[model samples]
Structure formats: structure tokens, C-alpha cells
Target chain A: MKKQTCSRILPLVALLWGVGLCACGDSAPELQRYELRLQGTTSRFSTTYLSATAVQVTLGGAPLRTELLPSSQRMNVANATHAHLVAHFWLRPEQVREGALEATVVLDDFGAFEGTDGSAGFVDAREAPLRLKLQGDALERNGRAVIHIDLDRSIGAERQGSRPLLPHLRLVY
Target chain B: MRLKRQWLLLSLLVPSLAAAHDLECEVSINEQSTLVVREYPATLTFRQVVRNIHPTLPSTLQEATDPLLEPLGWSFTPPPPVAIPVNDSRTYEFSVTVESLEDCARIGQVPPSESVEFTDTLQIGWDQGMATCSARVQCVPADTFVCDDTLYVSSSAGTSTELMPLDPTTLATTPVSSSTGFGYDAMGLSHIDGYLYAISNRNLSGDPIPHVVRVDRVGNIEDLGSLPELAGQEWIVGTIMEDGSYVIGSFLGSQWLRLNPVTLEVLGQGTLPTTTPTAWAANPLDNKIYGYQSYLARMSVFDPYTGDFTVFGPVLGNVGIQPCSCAFQQDGTFLLYCYTSDPTVDALFEVDLVNGVATLLGSTPSLAAGDMASCAFPPAQGATPAVRPSGYYMIHEAALERCLASGPVKLGLLPAVVTKEDALRLLWSSPAFTLGGEHRSEEQAARHALARQTLTGVCNQRLFGGTPELQRLLLDTTTTLGRTRAMSRLERHLGEANGRGLDVALPFSLRGRATPSHALEQLQPRSSP
Candidate 1:
């Protein structure tokens, strides 16, 4: 009877321990995630490098603080606009397990995508890139990043030419 | 003399205040193609629809007027931290979390412990130049981006100084083309080979249908002529093909047509993939096209070659992915930015062609432009060809303050696609006080609206053989559906109490540096001054 009681108590304790571990780590991770990517380019009219005063990125409903290379720390934009600009973003690929995503980029208080400037209709930007992608985990060790510099479109002003501002980010995980 | 000129300049500038002005809204998109912070409040469909629906009457609340929501189910307040932009016009969606979706199963409706009345402030960024190739963009932390002014301008206003900080909850208008190639303005968007397709329209007695014209963007305007093939079709929906071909579509006929970019001649024609194509995106793998055709709740794929099509995605009764744009990533995966009949807050879906599954990447109002590269036919998936928002907008005369007060305000609604064959055009108008349902006849109501107009008090009716302003208003909104400030101002100035006077109603370029009031004074008899 004593042996049976001790065995029964051990099983109950083991069950409780298993439950706690499941709650702590064994639970499923989120399958879906989304990110906001902001990219810039110059018009055919100019071949100068253009940079912004501030960079703010938002996703879902929260304001996401994105790391901008050469922020005020280094200078890619020298108080003037350039013919081209390349903004690179880093995001975790595992987050987009099985969900949806929405993204946008706007000018100060305005949606600047495909904007018609100086009373002109939206013009094709020769320097601004037209594509972004999330590199997979094993492929890119620093998480799936939205890269600005690709072989086709180099990031910089052909005149004062700057390569992709930040060569590579310090991979966190 | 210098002092006199300075005084003259000052006084001359003083009078023009009440002129017709523009209103613009800031918007953004995450990886999901959801529009955040829309200029107009009508974009609240995603967040509004995801609210829970009660099968039974609420014990705490009073009553339920429409039982339609009960049929449609709900999800947890869209997994919190999903920012939705709101305004007075569309705030009714916040307090009520319950919604009746089309195919909500067992857990259709749930009650929110607390009601979240959403509030958003417009964020402004650097305002230097204007013209751009695309309308909006979304970025990710999974990537590191450097912000600059040339390619990427910075945001200036809002607590968060991001340019046009858009919330993912907001939605945008469906893009339709009215190509009238008479290039006085900057509207013709399609670029194939050396020619640019434009909208060329005029209000002629027998000619109700506007026409499209192909003009050279870089050369003399006189060398161009009319494009007769697309003459009768008013709203010509189109995108550039892989081998420099063009695929133009008709929303009314649900017909797809292929044309040689050089000749503007129809190369091929086929029925539209969906009954109602909500959005259009280029196939990442090839020049094929994708549309939600939400009227059918399926992703209808279109091939420009034969004009043939295929249905992709689950046909599970109104899963309600109101497709925005069928954009793609660098690897050639399709991202269908979709919403629901209710504002089920926007979501991003990745179309897995291999398994035929539409995966959810995340949720957002817009997608990134960079995602288009390395993919097949980048322009089709939103390359430099993404139709960006026009710089200036027109506001209703009654909404002068909101239009010109500052930033983050909607100036006017775009003159999108208009159709007589079907009812898709009315989907973008203000849903408030709508006496009819979605399937209701918008044309009949417009006729009644025109019948009730009294424009005789104001004379000088010259256009359309001296027709009344009411008649002109309906004609422009329905027939020509254009994108000029003059047309927009004309639409809002009429049938409203507070108006931006007729003198100041002309486009800013024509009216010069005078204020609205001053401009109006100029229009008045010169002797009065």
C-alpha cells in the first residue's frame, strides 16, 4: 500500500512538471509575422544622392523604431538630396509562419509612394530601387533582411556615390 | 518704387484665401498590403469587419438592429498592436467588436473586455520634391534600411517623425485607368516601348465614352494622335507585359485584352478571370495577372497570351480576401493584400503556388517596392510601375478646412473607374446614409439626385450646351470620371452650403499666387475694386 501511494504521488508530480514545461517552452510559436520596408530613389531628372532628416517606420498599429545606418553617426546625405537612396531593413523570417502582411512608405505626414512632384506626374526614379526581399534563415545568418544593395542596383549617388550605407548589421540572434 | 512694389505684392497676395485647395492623407503598408492612415475614413473595412458577432442579443447592451453580422464570425480584436487609423466619419466601428462575417464558423463572435476608440495623428516627413514612381511602401526590421531624401524622403511631423505614417487598418481605392492621351496634364500612366498611354476625354454631345491616347513622354505633343481601339471603353485597366507587351482590361465587361504597346492594337482578348476584380497584380513567376474578384471570393489568375484564366486560392465561401494588389516578393511569391466586407483589419497573404495555399505573411495596408526585384515581371508585382497617389487632390467645398488646413487631410477622392455594365464603381463612395445596399443601383440614385438639383440661381453654364451644374456634376462623376483639380473642385463646389467660391475654383496653376478670396475678387467685376 505504501509503495502504491508513493508511485501514485510521483506520477502526479511528473504530470504537473510536464504541464509547466509545455506552458513555458513547448507551446507553438507564432506562425505569421509582417514587416514594414521603406525604400527611396531619385528621378530621371537628377543624378544626386537624396537623404532624409528623420526615418520612422510603423507596422500594424505600433510605431517601430527601425535602425538607420549612418544615422547622424555617419553621413551619407550631406544637407542635400541625392539621385538615389537605398534603405535596408532586417526582420525575422520565422515570424511569417502562416499569416498576412501589409506595408507602406510615406513622406512627412503624406503618402509619398508614386507621388507626382513639382506639379509633375509620378516619374520613374533612375536611382531608387524597385525591389525588396526577405533572405531566408540559413541563407542569411542575420535573419531575413530587406536588402537595399543588390548587384543590379548599387546603393549610392553616381556623382558622389555611396554604397549601401550600412554594409551589414550586427546580427542579434 | 521698391516699397510701392513690396506693398503691391503684399496687398495683391492678401485677397486670395478661399480658393479651391487640396487635401492629402498619409498612408503606409507593412509586408501585408494594408493601407494605414488613409486620407478618407472609408478605409476602415478591415478593423470594422473583424469585430465579434453575437448569435444572441447582448445581456449588457440594448439591442441589435442588423442580424447580418451574426452570420459572419469574428477573430480576437485582430491580435492587438494592430494599429488602425480612424476619424469622426468612421468611428462607429471601434466600440462594437462583434461582426457578422460571411463564413464565420463556431467562434464567429466574441465580446471585447474593453472598447478601443482608435485615434491617430498624421505623421509628416520631409517635403522637398513631389514626383515618385510608386504610391506607397512598407519596410521590415528583418532588414536594415538607410533613410535618405533623394530616394527616400524623411518624415517631419507627428510624434513619430515618419513620412506619412500609415496604419495597417486603413484601405485604399481600387485602381482603374481612364486613358485620354490628350496630354495637357500628367495622368497617362502606362509606359510600353517608347509610348506612354494617357486618358483623353471630352464632353461631346454624342460621345459619352472617353477615349485613350498614346503619347511620347519625352517629345513634342503634336506628333501624337488618338488611340481609336480603346475609344469607347472608358475605364481601361491595364499593365505592361513581360516582353514589352500590354494587357488592358475592362472592368465592366470583365474582359481582358492584350495590345501591342507600339500600335495600341488589340493583340488578344479574353473574359476577365473574376466576375469583379477588386485588385490587379502581376504574376511574380511570369507576366500573368491575379485579381481577387471578391464577388466570387477566389483569386482569379489571368494570362495575357490567350486571355485565358485560372482560379487560385480556397473557394471556401467568402473567406473574403478583398484583394488590393497581387504584388510579389523577390523569390516570386505572390502577396495578395486583402480585406473583408467588414473592416476585418487588413491582412497580407502569400500565395504558395506549389501547394496552392495562400499563406499569411503578416498584415499591412501596403507592400514594399523592393520585393518586386529578382521576381519575374517585377513591374506587374509593383515595381517602379506601382500607381502612386497624385500630388494634389480636390476637397468638397464644404470641407475646405480639412482640405487646406494642413496635412494628413483628404483633399478629394480620385476619379477612378466608372462603369455602366456593372456596379463596381459605387464601392468607393461614402457608405454613410446609403439608402441602398451594395447591389443597389447607383445610376438610378444618381438620376434621382440630378432630378433634385436647383442650379438655375447661378448662371454662366457653358459646357455641355449650357447644362445645369447638377447635370454636369453627374456627367463628370459617371461618364468622364477624370483626375483634374478643376474637375474635382467642380464636383465638390456644387450641391453644398459652404463652397470654395467660383472665382477661386480654377486649378492653382491657372489661378496664380492669389489667395482663394483674392482669386474670387479677380473673377468679380473689375470695377468693384
Candidate 2:
């Protein structure tokens, strides 16, 4: 009788453990994958490059900083506009609150994309954080969001012709 | 001395303002081909030079109109950034390439030489102000392009939605199609992606959702989707942007919504600084979205990418005439169509975008006071070269002689053709062909014979001392059958001339191959026979 009771209790405990494992798996939120796309207007990009080398996307108090890979950047000399897929990462749906999330994307302008720019010194730059709106449905449906930064929104004239001072930046998502 | 000092002071206060006004842009086709390979794609390259007309002031080349190359398959490539020094001009080269032609070529398009003329405008934004220059470009190899600036207007009558094809040149309306179940009241029709797109405020499903619908050439409405955020909104202004986005501005509120052309998904929404425009159209040359407020007679520009609205002061000098529908002329002229306070006094006015003046061209067919949309590019030229016979051929002996001279034989009698014989038989069979009397004079008999001959085929007008009326009949004879009959009538009239000394030398140019408008102008005013 004792052996049979022990066997029954062991089988029941094992079943409960398996059920708990399945429940935990169902309760945990699935992460949605997304890509960040950066595009500039063709008219302005033909003159000067958007000197941004890195981007940081922050959501729900957590930030994902990405140094743009060489394969990800397309600062070609072609006088045409292109949408560049710069970064890819995953995010939890819980990170989006109320069907919307405000993303603060920090752009670090290092002026070193393909080493085309001959400038060695830093140009007059502003560290203003660009804010973009990420729609929950957009990510849920398209699995990607775009942030377009206009280089024509520069504030002042270039100090020198070679190192054009890009002071102002506007973000459109 | 006071005037000079005031001028100096003005120059000091507004340096770039005057300099910007001196900036001029000239566009020239550097290279173009008359014959294009129908199977392969072709590219057209042109040069645009921004010259500072002012002898002293330097100007920066700021903004330009990125014209939407028409017929759906064309794309433009703008040159690199341009800058002009003092008294110097900067040249920029641009190219337009035919990306595809399979979709734009319509079925059953006739008269292969399709010619289109559209305006390309460049608005050079200087540091302080702006200057604009425009040039009309005639696109060649027009046979490949079938998409013409065919005007389509929609009605504002509640629940009575109708789309009609409007002739831009004649302002005539013909029914394309009409349907119910969608409320299109106060919505403007916009041509986008080879289809007419409009916003419907009516929630036919009884839900609080407004929908954007597409109307095809045959006027079939396809519901794209419903916009929940735009429910119960009255939008009279709508236009298709360069990025294929449909933007609708509110009629009552200052709100506007940019939507996906295919899905009607709300991509962006913003508020205008002032009241929204009642009429909106994208300039084909620049593809810039411009809005016209009929009540205020003011023009406004909307930047689709940034959601920026800039309104200019009154663009029409005559406030008496209110324009409810706005479109761009083929030459990049801003055209507004409407009437004065009196509904019957409506005409199409060409708005001078820079000076805010409007010149009335001619009367157009009045809509139900609704919005109008047309292709930015004009219909390919030489598409409709239908021959219109001269009405003078019936009355003037010289016209008959001229027609006979051109025939294979220079004889008093016309070469008898089967069509002429058939027409004469048909005329004789009718009771209307009775010779007035045997007592009639030779000229009278000849005129009656001419009338009978004309009535049988297309020229059914009796040239009885009404030259203008005869001219009108000739113009109205737009059918091929009518033209053929009129030609035969000319020959028959010459056959009866009896080789008499031609009284008037009617120019051959006025007879055939002349356009209707050209015929009207060339038919010199003459006393009745």
C-alpha cells in the first residue's frame, strides 16, 4: 500500500510540474522583432552626408544602443534617395503602453561613413535627441518602423566648405 | 534725395527679399528624341539654370517644383544641390525616365500621336523670400502616353454621387458613371495612381467611420477602407502627393489627414494654422500640394512630408468671382473655375501664382458647385486630328474651284465618286430635295443643289447668308461620316461651278487638315453670298 501511494503521488507531482511549465510558457509575453530604417531626402543628401554613425532606440526605460554595421550603412555617392535598414532587434509587446510608445533615438554624428568625408576634426554639432512615435499596430502588423531625418534642416551655414557644420536636425517618423 | 534715401533704407532692411525677386530659373531641353522605342524605355534629359537676374545681389537656390511626370510610369531625377553666386547662374541637369508603360496605356486609344504639354515650375527660395519661374514642356513620342488631363468632377449633393468626364478644353460633361450608397458630399476628387480617389463622409454602414474610395475610368467606386478617426468630418480639399499619399483637409476644422493610397490607413494627422482650403491640387511640374480658398481668394501650400502649411495673401484680384475648383494648367498655370455671385457667370480663370492675379480665359460648364480633378499633364498632342470640312465650300464658288484644283483632274466637273453618288441618291429620294422651280436663277439652283448635297452626309447646314451659323455647323460636325459627306459636297459644288471665273480665292489651308480652332480663326469674316 505504501509503495502504491508513493507511485501515485510521484505521477501526480510530475503531471503538476508539467502543467505548471506549460502555464509559465503561455503567460510569458512573446517578443516582436523589428528593424529600424533611416532615410534622407535625395535632394539634400547629394550635397553632404548625414554624419550619424550610431543610433540608440530607447523604450520603456530600456535602451538598445547599436553601432551601425558597415553593411548596414549606404552613404553612396549616387545622387538618389534610399531607405537604409540600419538596425534590427527584438522587443516585448509589454514595452508598448497604451497602443503607443515614444522612442528617443540618439544619433551620434561621427562623419565616418565609408571615410568619404575628408574632415578630421568635429564639425559644429548639436546633441539634441530626436523623438519618434512608434505605433503598436505598426510594429504588430508591419514589424518595422521608419525614422527619416532631414539634413536640410541644418541651422547655420557651414564654417568651412569641407566640413559643413550641420547644426540642426528634424526627425519624421 | 528723400526718395533715394528711402530706397537705400529699403535696400538695407530687405536685402535678400529684393535679391530673391531677381532670381530667375530657365528650363531647356538639352536632349530629347522625337521617335522613342515603344518596346524599350526611354529617358529625357533637360537643364534648369537658376540665374540671379540682379546685377549685384547673390541668391541661394532654395526650393524647386518636383514635377510629377505624368502617365504613371515616368520618374524624375533632380541634379545635385545648386548654389548661385552674385550675378552668376547655376546650371542643374535633370532627367525624366519612362520606368514602365504597360499600365498607363489604355485600351481602345485612337489616333496614335499622343502629345502632352505640362508646365515645369521652379520656385527658388532665397534666404528671405521666394521667386518662381515656369516653362511649358511638350512631351514627344506622345503615342506611348494615353493618360491625358481629363477632368473628373464629383457632386456634393448628399447621397447622390456621380463622376463625370469633363473636357478640359471645351468644358463639356459626359456621364461616366453614377452610384449611390456612398455619400460624397463636399469631397474633392483627386487623380492618384491612374485612378480617381475621393473621401466620403457618409458612413453607409451606419458606423461612425468615414471611407476613402477609388473611382476607375468607368466610374466604378471601390471602397478602400474606413477611417475611424475621420468620422463625421467634412473635407472638401484633397490631393495626391508625390509619395502616393492621399491628403484630405477638413472643411470645417483646420485638421488634415495623410492616408495611404491603397489602404486608407491614417499615416499622419496635423492641424493647419488657419482654415483649410476648399480646393486642392498638386502642381504637375513641382508636385507641390497647393490649396485654394474660394471665399478668401487666397492660395496656400502644404508640405506633405513635414505637415507644414503656408498661406499666401489673396491670389485672385477679383473677389467678386469665387473659384470652387482649382487645377494646374498644362503650362503650370494655377487655374480656378467658378463664377461670380451670379451662378451663371462662372468661367475658368488662370491664376498668376506670383502676383496674385487671375485672368479669365473662357466659360466652362458649371458643376453642381463641386470639386474638380484632372491629370496634371495635358493629353498627348496630335491625338485628335479629325478633319473638318470648310462650310464656305457650299456658298463660295472659289472654295469649290480650290477643291477641284486639288483633284486629279483640274476640270470644272468634280470626279464622281461612289459616296457622292450615294449621297445624291439619298438626297433625291427624300421629299426635301425638290428643285424650288424651273424659274430659279443659275446661282440659286446651284445653292439649292449644294444644300441638298450637304444635308445628305455630315454637313447638314443650309448656308443661307449666315456665315457664322455655317461656321458653327462645321465646328459641330465632329463625326467621320459628316466629314466625308462634307468633302463630297465640296466636290459636287465645284462640279456645278461651270468653270466660271472664281470670284474669291479660298485658301486651301482653310479646307482640310486644319484644327477646329484654327479653322475658326482662319475663316476670315466675309459678306454673305
- Candidate 1, residues B1-529, lDDT tens digits: the string is 9999999997776443211111112211221112222121122222222111122221111111112222334222333222223221111222122121111111122211011111111111111101111112111011111111101111111111111212212322222122222322112223122233323333222344444433322221221234555455533344445555555555466665565443344557766645636555455466677666666666677777666777766762424645344444435565555554545355556666556566665554332211111123322222111111111111011122222223221112322211210111121111111212121134433332222121211111211122122333434334433334433344333332111121123323222221211211222121110
Q: B264 in model 2: Cα distance from truth in Å?
A: 2.0
- Cα error, residue B375 of model 2, in Å, equals 2.4
Tell me the lDDT of candidate 1.
0.29
lDDT of 2: 0.47
Clashes of 1: 145
> Residue B462, candidate 2: how far off, in angstroms?
65
Candidate 1 segments whose C-alpha is farther than 4 A from its true place: A1-173, B1-207, B211-228, B231-236, B273-276, B316-323, B343-347, B360-529
Scored against the true structure, residue A22 in model 2 reaches a CA lDDT of: 20
